[model samples]
Target: MKLSSLQAIPRCFHTTRWSLVRQATADDSAEALDAMETLCEAYWYPLYAFIRRSGYSPEDAEDLTQGFFARMLDRDILTTADPGRGKLRTFLLTCLRRFLAHETERRMAQKRGAGLIVSMDTTWAENRYLHEPVDHLTPDRLYQRRWALTVLEHTLRLLKDEYEDKGKGVLFEHLRPYLGLGVEPEQSYEAMAAKLGQSLTNTKTQVFRLRQRWRELLFEQVSMTLDDPSSEEIKAELSELMQCL
Candidate 1:
């Protein structure tokens, strides 16, 4: 998704760097495991995509992805994550590169589906990979693009849940497209007002509010991936991610 429309969103602040990493690496408690699992679920596919771009077959990529996570969890590799180094996106990709270099032979020798640590929807992952545009993106570039999309997807999910909780689930579905640029003329505010049974003015107002909330949520989501980023740093990161799209 192009993020030009979201450029106006204000910066958001949050204390703590690599809170999720810290939580995931803190101990072997259930909470820590849950944190680690959440990270895995959010990012597994991007790593998978990277592996595929690096020339692994889908089956091999699936096995390697699973093995990488298994090794990460089993050996408590996250304990080595340093917030001062950079974002989690960079950290994971670096670790994955190292794993592939040293552990590929050992991991590939194991039976398929052995030592599964984190559950993933490999079927869905492969389908998504199949649909990707055949572009000139290198493995690293594709990883960054996928990572940006992942963040946007998570932000949209949060927005959807918020609207659903307020009994405006259907309205959210209609307004969602307006949160981004390039909505067709046929899907104009007047049409939305008619469908929503509200004044056109009110429909426009709702769209504005939706876009604002989306910006706020997107900012918060991006902020979480950094290590106590300044406002300028967050904006720069967002800009780079937007370029990836």
Candidate 2:
């Protein structure tokens, strides 16, 4: 669907998120450079995971990932991204695949960490990679799962920050496990109420409100990636991402 059709949809919450993508496509103004940096920081891990799964050594993968971002920014490749074509993740993955196929030799020959574009925590990334299942899923499948997980992690972090800002950090900690379906909470509602100095009914209500806000935030997060932020498109993307989990 075209983004113009969704013009009437309220976009106050999504403007900042989508602006990063839109701005990154512009000439090298400060805002555009900052936007592209933020996108790379948030999304570099999934692409790295894809590369590692594709059989490159950790050292080579790191070099390739850094080189890809460096080339992408220096060469103005992001100017080619057309939101109307599809989601941003798809565009990035396609570019990364093409880079791997064509640029491996040249990138590997370069000095490690030469022209680093994004600051990635290599230790954290490698540790995370070590924990992934040893199943025979293809690299593409691993990338999809990693992308879905990254979105969920980002959304939860946002929610936690909001709660902390309101001085409800402890409440959020207790209620977090209940945010996911089928994940049993360690404490009963009655016990939680007593600990928080609230009635059992109030505790239940808080849980309900938390879950509701999570859904709202999740929807907004998914909407930020779409060219057409229509309700139907958002729902379809959310469904597909959830299935990847």
Candidate 3:
């Protein structure tokens, strides 16, 4: 998902960092486990993409990412995460950077470990990373792009789940393309309305609502990735997200 394709959102929302971090630090409680798992599930792809771009083979990258998360979770490292230092994403990257500096040697000295921090479909991840554009983008650049894509994807999943819960899954499927830049050029409200047995005016209204919901969801997702997302900070992050696309 490119920045240009995302719907523009003009609302300001606030989120604080360290909610999960605080939970994770408290003897690794169930809440902490859930929070850590949620984060790992949402972010492993970007981390994996960064490792791959750093020249690790797919297998090695997978191992390193798993090991990194394992260490993070097991050690409750997030408790030490200082929001004052930087954004959460940057902190993760810094951790990965430090990990990569010695991971090769450490892995070679010991057998591959068991139990990934969270179970990931390694095959699915490799397939996705394999198709990433072959360009001059640095590892950091690729990670940022993948991060933005992941945030957008997470928003879509949440939105889709909401639609499914309301028994509007079919409506969501029908209207999804209109919410992005990848809409079929030939597809139009007239055609969509006809296909869905609705009037053109109704179809247009639905699309508008869908886009608005999408923007809200997008902002919500992005806000979670920061410390305290101020109005200007959110705008800047949104702009950076667009540029990543």
RMSD of each: 2.7, 4.8, 3.0
Instruction: Give the per-residue lDDT digits (tens) of candidate 3, residues 99-156.
Output: 8987756654434547657787889999998898889789999999998888878788
If both were scored by lDDT, which would come out higher, candidate 1 or candidate 2? 1
Candidates sorted by lDDT, descending order? 1, 2, 3
lDDT of 2 at 22: 59
Which candidate number maximizes lDDT? Answer: 1
Clashes (candidate 3): 3
lDDT of 1 by residue, 1-245 (tens): 44556665554475433565566656557765666677788889999999999999999899889988877776777778886865878889998999999864564667888767778788989999999998979999999999988988888899999999999999888888886633543388888899999999999999888888888887777776777776666777888888888
lDDT of 2 by residue, 113-204 (tens): 77688998888999999899999778899999998888888889999999999999998988987765335656788888998898999999
TM-score of 1: 0.87
Give the worst 10-residue stretch by lDDT in candidate 3.
13-22
**C-alpha lDDT (0 to 100) for residue 236 of candidate 2:** 76
Q: What Cα-based lDDT does every candidate model obtain? A: 0.80, 0.78, 0.77
Candidate 1: residue 142 Cα off by (Å):
1.1
- Considering only N, C-alpha and C atoms within 3 Å, which residue pairs clash in candidate 1? none
Cα shift from native, residue 11, model 2 (Å): 6.9
TM-score of each: 0.87, 0.87, 0.86
Looking at model 1, residue 216 earns an lDDT score of 82
